[model samples]
Target: MVSRRGTKSKTPGSKRTSANPPSRKQFNPSLHRFQERYEQKEFQAKPHGIPVRVLSFMGVTVLAMSMYSGYLYASYQREVSKAQSLDVPRDVSDRYNSTAPTFDAEVELSEKAMRLGKKRGDLIRLARGDVLEVSCGTGRNLEYYDLGERRGTDDQGHAAVIGCRSLTFVDLSPQMVDITREKFQAANPEFTHVAFRAQDAGAVTVEAPARVRDLAGAGKDASDHRAYYDTIVQTMGLCSMADPVGTLRHLGEITEPERGRILLLEHGRSHYDWLNRILDNLAPLHADKHGCWWNRDIGAIVEESGLEVVEVKRWHFGTTWRYVLRPKILCGEKK
Candidate 1:
C-alpha cells in the first residue's frame, strides 16, 4: 500500500528505515522496575560459604579431643613406667595408717567400688563360734557379725554379755588395729571376748592374740591351731596383702576342717577376655598404687590356696567374687 503524500508508505508492521530509529523507549518504568529487582536478587544471593562460627566450633572440638587423647596417652605411659619398676610398695602399713580414717570414704569414691553394696554385713553374718577375721580393717565387719545370744566367758570365766565365744580382729596397720579395737569395743561393749592384733596375717603364729588356746583349754594340742577358730572371714583384704597366696595358704592351714567355713568378699580379675586384658594392662598401676593385683584370678587363687570352694557368686564382669571356702580334707583326715 502507498501513502497519499509519499512514494510508498511503509506498512505499520514494516521495519524502520532510519539507521538509529528512536531506541525502544530507552526505558519502560514497569520493565525497568523488574530488571532492577532481578539485579538486586542476583547481588543478594551469595555463594554457599561456611559460617565462621561453625568452622571455629568444629576446629576447636577436634583440637580439644586430640589434646585430651594425647594427654591421657602421656599420663598412661608415665603411670605404666612407674608401675613396672616397683613391686607392690612396702609402705602398705604406713599407707593405711595415714589413710585409715578416710579409707571408707576413699572406697566410696566410686559407686562401682562398693562391689554391689555393703557386703561386709553378709561377711559377718557367716561367722559363728570362735571367729577370726584376717586383715580386719577398721572393724567394718564388727557391726555385722551375728554375735547371737550366747554370752562369752567373763573375767571370772562365766558367760556374761551374750555374743560369740571370741572374735579376733587382725591387721598389719597399727592404726587399723586401734580403729578396730575402738569399733569392736563400741559394738560389743558387754562382750570382752574381742582381741585386736596388729601383725601380718600370714605370720600370725602363737604370738598373735588369738582365742584358740583359750577356747581349746589345756587338754587341746597347742600345735593344732586349726581347731581353735570355727569360722574365718575375709573381705577385700586378700587383694592388698603383700603375699595373697601365702596368706591364703596360712588361712587354709588355720581354718578347721570338716565343719569350719571361710567366707570371702573380694574383687579381682574380670571374666570377660577384653576386660581382663584391660585389667592386665592396668595391673602394674593398680599394684603400685593400691598394693593389690587387680588382675589376679580370685577363683584360681582360692583353688591354688588348697581351699575347697563350695560356692562362688561372681558379678561385675567377674571382677567381684563372693566365695564360700572350706578346708580340703587332708589325706589322713579323709573318711
Candidate 2:
C-alpha cells in the first residue's frame, strides 16, 4: 500500500511513492535466457611470459653464438692485423656497381638507427673552399655541406677569404657515381660548381677553377691544379680499399699543404677487446657479402699514411672513427 499525491492514506504498513516513479525494465525471454552468469573461474597457474622451453632454446642459441664468436675471434683478429689487401672476396668497384641501385635502401634503416646523419653533418659542415669527397657513395653527405663560396680558415690556421671554389665527388663505382649525380643535380640545378666522377680517387685529379687556382697559388699557367683541395672527405671507404694507407697518402698529396683537411668517418677495430672480437668474428662473412673488410685498425692505417692527425673521435665502442687529418708539412718542420 502507498500514499496518494496530496492525501496521505495512513495504512498500517504503507509507504510514500513519488509522483513520477522510475519505470521498471521490461523482461525479455531471449535476453534473460542469455544473460551473463557470475561464478568462480579456475585460476590459470601456467607460468606467464616466455615459455620455459622457448627460454631454454634462446639461452642455448646465445651460448652457441658466443662460443662460436669466441672460437673465431682470435684467428680473425690475426688476419685483420695482417691487413691483407685482397682479403675481401670481390673488388670494391664491381661489388658496389652490382649493389648500387639498392644501396640507399639497404643502408637507410641502419644509417637512421646509427644516427649517421648528425655525425656526417659534424664533418661536412667543416668543409669550406674547394672540396673533394672520395668514396662519395650515393652522395649521402650532400645535404650536410655548408655550400657556396664562404670565408673560412686555411690549413696553416690563417683566416683567408679563398677564391672561386668547387665541390668534386669521386667514386670507383660508375653506377654509384651516376646515382649520386642524379640526386644532387636534381636537387641543386642552380649550383654549377659541382663535378661527379666515376674513377679511382687515388689517381684521379680535378682541374681547379681560376679563383681556386689563384688562391692555391697553382699559377696562371699550371695545367694541373690537383693539389688544391681545401677539404677532402671519405666515409666508410677504408674497409674496401686494397691499400687504405696508400690511398690516404694520395689524398694527402692532393690536399692543400697549408690548410687542407682530410675528414674521415670510418668503422674499424673497437677500443674494447670484446667488441673487437665480435667485429673480427663477423669480418670474413661481412666482407664476402658486403665487400667491406670492416675490422682493420684505422689508427694504424692513418699512422702509416704519413698524414698528421689534427683531431680524432670514436663512437660505438670505438668501432666508429672520425679523424681530421692534415698533410705532415702542417706540423711546421722546416724544409
- Best candidate, lDDT-wise? 2
Task: Give Cα-based local distance difference scores for all models.
Answer: 0.73, 0.80
Q: Estimate the overall C-alpha local distance difference test score of candidate 2.
A: 0.80
- Once all C-alphas are superposed, what RMSD does model 2 give against the true structure? 12.6
Q: How far is candidate 1 from the true structure (C-alpha RMSD, Å)?
A: 13.1
Tens-place lDDT per residue, model 1, 4-40, is 8867876779886777757575667999899999999
lDDT of 2 by residue, 160-221 (tens): 76433678889999998999899988887888888888878778675644134443243334
Off by over 4 Å in 2: 1-90, 152-164, 208-227, 330-335
**Model 1 Cα shift for residue 251 (angstroms):** 1.7
Q: Assess every candidate by TM-score.
A: 0.66, 0.68
